[model samples]
Target: MSVGLTQPIWMEMALALLILPGVWCTSWLVLYQDVCAVRGSSVVILCTYHYPETLVNKNLTVEKVMWSHGRKQFFDGPFIIDSNNRTHTATKFEYVGNKVHNCTLQIHQVEQSDSGEYAFRFETNNGGKWTGSNGAKVNISELIISMTTPKVHGPIKEGDCVNLTCMNNCSSAVMWFRNGKPLQEESSTLYLCDISFQDSGNYSCSPKHHNRPLSEVIRVSVEYSPRNTSVSVWPSSEVLEGSDVTLTCSSNANPTLNYTWFKIDGDSCLEMVSQAELQFNVTHTGNSGKYFCVVSNKHGRQNSTILSLKVKDHAEGMAAVTLTILLAVLAVVPMIVIVPMVTWHLVAHRKKTTAPKPDTEENTQTTEVHVTSPTSDCSLTEERREEEPSQQDEVPYATVHITKQRANIQQQNEEATAIYSSIWEQQAKEDLYSVVSRPTPRGKQAQDDPVIYSTVFRQ
Candidate 1:
């Protein structure tokens, strides 16, 4: 225990040795992990280290680092170092380094050609050699390029300008390609400048900087047909009186196309339907025919199929013809029905009108004879009266008028005279017809006629 007071420095050094690891850990390694950048952007790679203790006390140093282009090969032969101390030169590569400990490699203005594997070798304490695993890979990219061209999807008509346009994708540059060649001004921008129908064809754009492939091609077509291309008559389908036969045009046209119309007058293809649209207001048989549309554009002209529009029903004349026919028919049908009925009625009426009324005088004379001749001697007297009768008495003086209109008059007279007769009044103008009138004697004067004769005339 007294000996312990005399401490030993050797013990302290032993304790320090036991607590620490044998070496300082410094070795070439990839410190910062991999990274990514846009096609035209920049990128960087980092390296770190842990050195052994035996090398730290000694004049140990990281001499140099190197990269190899192994794009075509999986493994590469050793290449030159990028360090200032190392002696190497190459046309394909140039490298710069950082200070001794940092040991960084910088490639200037990196391009797609710089994408490849890299490796590092170092000279250490006592000149020991150390090499790392396969080096990190660097990648470069091209700028984005997207281009478009308009392609008309409809049919082509005369006089269309065929306008076209080219567009680049968002955040991209547009370059127009025509006939497999890029224009100098067009290629400068990643976009289309101007376009037209003449620009119609396959088009594409090359990616900028990095070795990206060209975009797919697009085709543009510009074309338009005339709108509402219709042929019409000047006076419409119906021709009217006192109007000029003029044809006019009404349609939408591109490129200011001209129009012509034709007419099929008889067998000849005359230009009756000219003036764009045929106008035959004072239209006659000559103005009717087949019509055609002739449309001309800046590029060329086209003819439409023939349209036969016969000028017929005019606004004024149309109604008149129809009305006349209707009037004629209306007039004729009633006559057809009424004429026969009226004729039959008239014939029957005329027969009735001319027929004698019941011979009331003869009846009275006979009745008077019958009554007065209640004695057989009066019969001889009545016989004498009959023989003495006049020529007028031979035929009936009481005629009956049996016209339909005067039937009531005939009915009233029949009750008083025991006889019937009628007469019809004329309508107007010339007398249309006439009927007979009969007279009736009524009251005791009829009964007291001395000439009256009564005889039982049996059926």
Candidate 2:
């Protein structure tokens, strides 16, 4: 059974040795011969004594019994127990005897200093005293576990044998333990064969007793090859293009080690970097594949399982989405401003060309207009009028009214009485002339900006 250092708790003993006396009488004192006990445990010495009923006038009444263990006197010492003066005795020792025969002594929480011979003494009512000279000897020893192994060439590796011995010359049967748990070993020599990492721990041993005491702890360390090799990837999710990724290799081993990385290319494996970690600045999908790692040391080597990788092309995907967004913007722009603006301009231009207003002269193309700057104005020519007075009186010119009104249509022969026709119809050519306006760079004007016309006719 497994045992731990507690407040002196109980245990399961495989065997028990009962020291019962079959017969006893006619002796003044009876004591145990010799015994062995462990530390932190209680020890009992089976003892008995006899005394006569009477000695002269004093009655042989055994009133007091005392015990001594490796001391000068059983009546006076630090390690003494008295039956009569139980209150004056120290708590470490107890005398469980009666007035008749039993003189058993009990020692609690035994230590190394408690190891020695134990003697018993008795006193009667009349001052009759007797002490047992042949005392029972008690051997005290502390238990511990010690280790021994063959000289290793380098280090104690797997499949090596280790021997663990219960120490301090402990003569009792002991149980071997590792890390507070009991093993199947019972003897003092514990054999560890084909030891591995599982065999490494703090080993101990304890004597087979109900109130057992554990030995001093001894650590056992075992070294072996790389085991449980594994690979870990940074950015554990989907990897993007133009990003950083790292893969790390790890294993359980003793001493120093070396790490090697690999990648599965198509159907074959390719050796990559030779370090504990490998970093890559991913550029394209070409960097996506299955990868693994191998760890090694002076003892042996091991390989890890494959880890899959895939790189996503983020740049190209963003470009395609950007083009789609620009196209959507272009499709909606014409409806918002361009189409409405062009429609407004075309409607304004068509109104200008189709119909002309009747009262406004600037919009009518049929009206003949005469415009002059402020510096050029026509004046009333009284001298020209005086020079052609006779011709002006003989030819009376018709008045022309300027208005923006459409005229009635007429045939050319019906309205042939123009000024040019009248001038060509003149029969007497006696230099007939009248004042006329000159169509040149110079002109005369009245204050009201008026025009005048004159003509000569033969009578």
Top candidate (lDDT): 2
Off by over 4 Å in 1: 1-28, 32-56, 69-77, 80-87, 106-116, 140-459
Question: Global lDDT of each model?
Answer: 0.45, 0.65
| RMSD of candidates 1 onward, in order | 27.4, 27.2
Off by over 4 Å in 2: 1-27, 39-42, 53-62, 83-100, 127-129, 142-145, 152-154, 167-172, 210-213, 232-235, 239-250, 255-291, 309-459
By summed lDDT, the worst window of 10 consecutive residues in model 2 runs over: 1-10
Cα lDDT of model 1 by residue, 182-288, tens digit: 65534434333343344445645543343332445555443334555665545455454455655555555445677776656667765543346554454465555
**lDDT by residue for model 2 over 20-75, one digit each (tens)?**
12211232445464667777667787776665464443456777777777636533
- Residue 421, candidate 2: Cα error in Å is 99
Candidate 1 Cα deviation (angstroms), residue 129: 2.8
What C-alpha lDDT does candidate 1 achieve relative to the native structure? Answer: 0.45
